[model samples]
Target: MPNIKSAIKRVKVNAKANVANSQAKSAMRTTVKKAENAIAANAENVQELVQSAHKALDKAASKGLIHKNAAARKKSRLAKKA
Candidate 1:
């Protein structure tokens, strides 16, 4: 509902960014959950799951989707579990 041209463009761009960020965050959370489940179940692919989770966390942090410290903390916790 932005009347100004620049404002309308900004709104559109923000909407696109929001969708992309949401997807990235969702994927990251799913990866972390998978790693946690694998660890708890004593699964054979626990290492791979953990590694993917770490990668997802790093990607999210680097993209500003999550705080760097937050990502580090999650990574540490995942490591501990593994």
Candidate 2:
């Protein structure tokens, strides 16, 4: 829909970034959910799950897929649950 060349390029770039960000965010959320579920179930592997979740959150935050403080908050909550 963008007629201008730069505008068209921008649109494409944005679309690509959006897809990548969405995937990263979804993965991060899934990891967090796993950690939470482990906690809820009193699973012995909660620490391992939390660690992986924190790593995923940090990776997402570093890539600008999620806010740094939001990631930190989530990590803190996950840690607290363990």
Candidate 3:
């Protein structure tokens, strides 16, 4: 609970941003899981899955939702699996 009005507003803004960030992170994770599942299933759509995963990771990194190195690491691992 923020005592100051400005602090209360800031908290509200932060809560909104937190929800948005969480959604983005969840999307990234879902995309990565899809890619990994495709790889594991030996699906013909592995390429598409990999591409989607890469794009999602890049977007997350660009948005500052994830670290650049972390994104690169995820891309590298996915590429290797693909």
Candidate 4:
């Protein structure tokens, strides 16, 4: 319960950003998991899935949802797996 108008606005903005960040992070994780599973199964679409995962990681990192180094490491590991 923010008493000041500014504080109230800040709370609303923060809540919106939180939801957006959560969705982005969730999508990134899902992409990575799909790639990992495909790699484990030796699926033919492994390359596509891994590529999408890399793209998702890059997007997340660029958006500051994740650290750039973390994104790079994940991408490297995913590539190694594929």
Candidate 5:
């Protein structure tokens, strides 16, 4: 435990941020997976799913949740897979 008041506050803030970042990352992964599944199943709405996945990846990248290169790489792979 942080004994200093500011340290304690910082710890709390970091904890909250961790939770938020984890949720965002999880949602992004789910979006990407949905796109992949649509590809595998040859779903009619695959385009829409891929678009959604791209949006999610871009959003996460812009938010600094993931590296821009990582996002770009994933988007490229998704496009190739489609």
Candidate 6:
């Protein structure tokens, strides 16, 4: 539906970026969930799970997929739960 050539190119780039962003977000959520579940189940490896979650959050933040404060908050909460 884009009338200009640049607009058409923008649309294509936006679609690709959207998919990449979505995948990163999904992975971040999954890592957080795994950490939470480990805590809830009273797993002995909670520390490892927390570390994994923190790594994922840091990576997401570094990639500009999430705010640094948001990532810090999540890491703090996960650490507290563990």
Among these predictions, the greatest lDDT belongs to 5
Across residues 46-82, which tens digit of lDDT does each residue of candidate 2 receive?
Answer: 8899999999999999998889999999989888888
The stretch of ten residues in a row with the least summed lDDT in candidate 3 is 73-82
Q: Write the per-residue lDDT of candidate 1 for residues 1-82, one digit (tens) a residue.
A: 9899999999999999999999999999999999999999999999999999999999999999999999999999899989
Model 4 lDDT at residue 44: 95
Tens digits of per-residue lDDT for model 5, 24-69: 9999999999999999999999999999999999999999999999
Model 2 poorest ten-residue lDDT run = 73-82
Q: Rate the local accuracy (lDDT) of all candidates.
A: 0.98, 0.92, 0.97, 0.97, 0.99, 0.94
Error of model 1, residue 79, in angstroms: 0.4
Select the stronger candidate by TM-score from 2 and 4: 4
lDDT of 6 at 73: 97
Native-structure RMSD, model 2: 0.8
Question: Candidate 3 overall Cα lDDT vs. reference?
Answer: 0.97
Using all chains and alpha carbons, the TM-scores for the candidates as numbered come to 0.98, 0.94, 0.96, 0.98, 0.98, 0.94
- Tens digits of lDDT, candidate 4, 33-78: 9999999999999989999999999999999999999999999999
- Measured by TM-score, how close is model 3 to the native structure? 0.96
User: How does candidate 4 fare on TM-score?
Assistant: 0.98
Error of 5 at 7 (Å): 0.3
Q: List the residue pairs that clash in candidate 5.
A: none
Runs off by more than 4 Å, candidate 2:
none
Model 5 CA lDDT for position 16: 99
Which residue segments of model 4 deviate by more than 4 Å? none
**Candidate closest to the true structure, highest TM-score:** 1
Error of 2 at 74 (Å): 0.9
Q: Give one digit per residue, the lDDT tens place, for model 6 in 32-82.
A: 999899999999988888898999999999999999999999999898888
